[model samples]
Target: MSVRSLSATLALSAALVGVGVPTASARPATYELSGDAGGSKFEGIGYDARTQRYYVSETTGGEIHRGQLRSAAATEWLPGDGTDGRWTARGVTVDSRGRVYVAGGPNGIDHPGAPDLWVYDRDGRLLAALRTGVPNAFLNDLVIGPDGAAYVTNSNAPQVFRVAQEHGRWTIRTWADATATIATQTGFNLGGIVLSPDRRALVVPQGNVGKLWRFALSTGTVSAVDTGAADLVNADGLVQDGHRLWVVRNFSRVLTTLQLSSDGRTARLASATPTDPDRVLTTAKLAQGRLLLVDSKFDEPTAVPPYQVITMTPPRR
Candidate 1:
């Protein structure tokens, strides 16, 4: 239970007895921000509190773009020299020192030995190079948690892993293992993972099966973060502002948030963006008090490229 030796616990995924979740409805307004990036598949998004800027990474193009996140219309943050314009970027993270880290993989295929995690300054200057050799670790989304450790998600392996800055190389640890083989399900890929404000729990959404899982940092055990969805809802990105767990249901097309219990298990739906039937994959990012979401435009075979990033300033009632 004490994660000092990296000899973490190996407990089987629990909550197998609960087969179904009761249906419920949530209320959140859909606000669309005006901007387009040519249908790029936006993988990871983060907001800088220091500069008040929003960063979204392009999965396919390797473009880590900057954008102004405001109540009004927003524009894309074009790449820079030796910064954005010069390098291919994937999962991105802005550290406490204001350093930005991006993940680099060979476009789509397995480019082994290729450093996937890249670092940049606030001005987009390449700072550090990081690579992890976790089997099938196709880096997707990256986030610097409240404790300052960088956590990443891999789509292919469908596992949530972490990296620590030790000596110079980014020492890696297999922090989260949400393998689908344990669940007897096909699509349990952990897409986005984030820690709660208390640093006791991690809220993660699966892209294939549309489920949210809450794992305890102390116990290293996982439970159903959200049990409501029973189909291909495609839960993707996640972020937590201390208390509530905000998740983007990619296939269901809704932004939902729920409160985490003090014990770090069981996630109940608290709020959800209002959507009409047939709407889909509502991706989201939470920064400060603002929630940024995008209405994915589906162009299958090609997929949803540069999914539109929309901003909504929720009225605090």
Candidate 2:
């Protein structure tokens, strides 16, 4: 292998070593991404377990970066030419077949196009750009269901967009529209989302209320997940592992862990751990037992080398 490829392989091997091991005994470590020092506005994160590579999406620049675990060097893997000045990249998820689906916006009043779901191949080639016809659609985070359907959340509107293959072509439309009780948003509603263990429902947190909600897949029903006295408060990116929920509170700089009841209607606080407080972390992905986070720092002036992904062991509940 070439020198650069060899280095990446070594780093990935080290990262994979901790995948199956329990995080309760693992120590936290931070790996800085080195390459493309431009203003990326990195926000969303996704991990491809098959290749042991993590994908980070840019919010404003519309670029996708690929890096190995435990490595400081990351290459500019996908430069979505259309994303540069017009569309913006938000959340991203990679399917079992290595197909990458990216979320974008109904932003730039002058841009004049609905939000879209951009799909790409493993090589970063643009495969399809599926648009959500919803007006002012701020397509935020997304999750791929067991049946190969994509469920994406819209922070601006009280709805979820679903993309599926029909007649050999992809189609996008509103899957669920939240009713009055659960579709609340102070600034950004429904930031991060994940599917339930059984893949029958989606668990999401309201950014404004800091409360969690469950949306049934079989039925277009929405209900709040009782947290008793605790609130996810500012919940952003979320990942579900069995009965445990891992959430990122961006503004608070903390990762909150919760244990869900058997029926998936209630949750209770397990633990909350501190992350890099100075930087704003938007989303997280689980690689084996390790959790990887991307630093968006959206409002801050762009840094020289920009920010890096923070990898650590999830706090014990």
Candidate 3:
């Protein structure tokens, strides 16, 4: 769809969906990302609440974009095209220490010398570019754990990699392997992930099977989360506030809300709201009481410019 048609369709959908839309006075509604000549497509987004800065990753190349909460345009923070041995980037999350962690999706699968993930300090200096040592690892999305480490999801396999600095040295290891519990599928096996409100477990969605799995942080045991009757197919990025969870179904263009049990074992579907029909929002981060969603443009046959990270009010339960 053309840009004009897409905006009009989104405006109409917002009115019909009955959700609170962001007015221009409140925010710009959408934050633009710097584009590349290759028709840069984006995926994961990370927000630094402390600095009011947000980071976005370009999928076509390993470039990372940075924008501020008050700014309308993001500038390129990191260059792609094999810079730092990174050819492509995926999920991104910022640690409490202002460090940025980026997932290299399928970058290491074909090239053994390529990095599977990268870590950068607050100044955008490369700290580490290491591989998980897992074969065919498709590092998709990641979330910062309570222990001040990054837990990344492997889309090609049922595994989670823990990337952290140990004894002044950076290391990447397979922290949890759920091959027996969660079966690997054709498409993305695991996509979006979030920590439970209690901070006891990691809640992840298996997009191919439309299932939720809780990975216990203490024991590393994986169990299925009972999300009764919620069609969570294509579930991508996850955002959690207390027991409330928002699941962004990318291709389906649906934002699903669920109330989780205190222990994070079960969930009740609250609502399934339709998103803009023209964009595929891959992931989101909650910042300043609003959601900054990445409009991935993965659905477009040929993506256009003015790529954006749109803002929306949290859906009411």
Candidate 4:
């Protein structure tokens, strides 16, 4: 279906479901992204609350698109066609200082001279791009740690990389390795990451196995999270507000909600909500009091344009 027709259908569906259309003065319910000729598919999203701008990554070619809370469309911020040695990009996050960190998924696995991640300043200037020096490393998603460093998840292995500027230079090092605790799987292992409510540990989901693990910030110890009987398979992006956590299962088309404990060791399944049936919602970020989800279009054999980022009301705890 064409973009216009698809949009109209979505509007009708929303209206039928009791979601009224936004007025002209209100923020747009959907933000359109520029299309790529060779079937562009998006995955990750990052929001800069300070600047009111959000970034989306194109998996087909590592291009980055930027949009604002007031705008209805996003423009390509960075070219992806092998620019800066990045052929494909995945997760993104903006730190307090406005530095943008992008995870290059499998970009450096077998390719020589490709970076595993890239860091850009607020003004879109390249700051650093370095490889994680791990074979078959698939850096999927990342989150800024409490110490202002980027903690990236590796899907190919049970490892988290610490990217930071120490002394005066930038460096990438293995911050935590849970090979003994978390076994390697055929598909993506550790996908989405978020900090606990108390900010003492990192909550990471093993997507392939539908399991959650807590990585201690102080000691880097890994422990299994007790998610009793909650099927969180294909969990992609995660958003946390207080003790409530929203897990976006991309292929499953369901948003699983969980209430975490103070220390982030255990979780109780609160609710499971199904998303839109048409779009495969991947990573999401909370901006302007709404949840902006990336309609990755991964389920499509050849993605149909124009691509989009959809908005929805966040689930209340």
What lDDT does the true structure give each of the candidates?
0.55, 0.74, 0.89, 0.88
- Between candidates 2 and 3, name the one with more favorable lDDT: 3
Please give the clash total of every predicted structure, in order: 13, 0, 0, 0
lDDT digits (tens) for residues 19-38 of candidate 2:
22123333334445543456
Best by lDDT: 3
TM-score of candidate 3 to 2 decimals: 0.96
Q: Write the per-residue lDDT of candidate 1 for residues 78-160, one digit (tens) a residue.
A: 34223433234455567777777665533323454556577667876666555665655566677776667777776666466
The residue ranges of model 4 lying beyond 4 angstroms of the native Cα positions read: 1-25
Q: Candidate 4, residues 1-317: lDDT per residue as tens digits?
A: 24663575466556554332223347887898996976889999999999999999999989999999989899999998799999999999999999999999989974666999999998889999999888889999999989999899999999999999999899999999999999998889999999999999999999888999999999999999999998999988999888988899999987788999988989998877767778798988988668889999899999978699987676664
Which has the higher TM-score value, candidate number 1 or candidate number 2? Answer: 2
Q: Is candidate 1 or candidate 4 better by lDDT?
A: 4
A best-first ranking of the candidates according to their TM-score comes to 3, 4, 2, 1
Q: How high is the lDDT of residue 300 in model 1?
A: 43
| Alpha-carbon TM-score of each model against the true structure | 0.70, 0.86, 0.96, 0.93
CA RMSD, predictions in order: 11.9, 6.4, 1.8, 2.5
Q: Judge candidate 3 at residue 131 and give its lDDT.
A: 88
lDDT of 2: 0.74
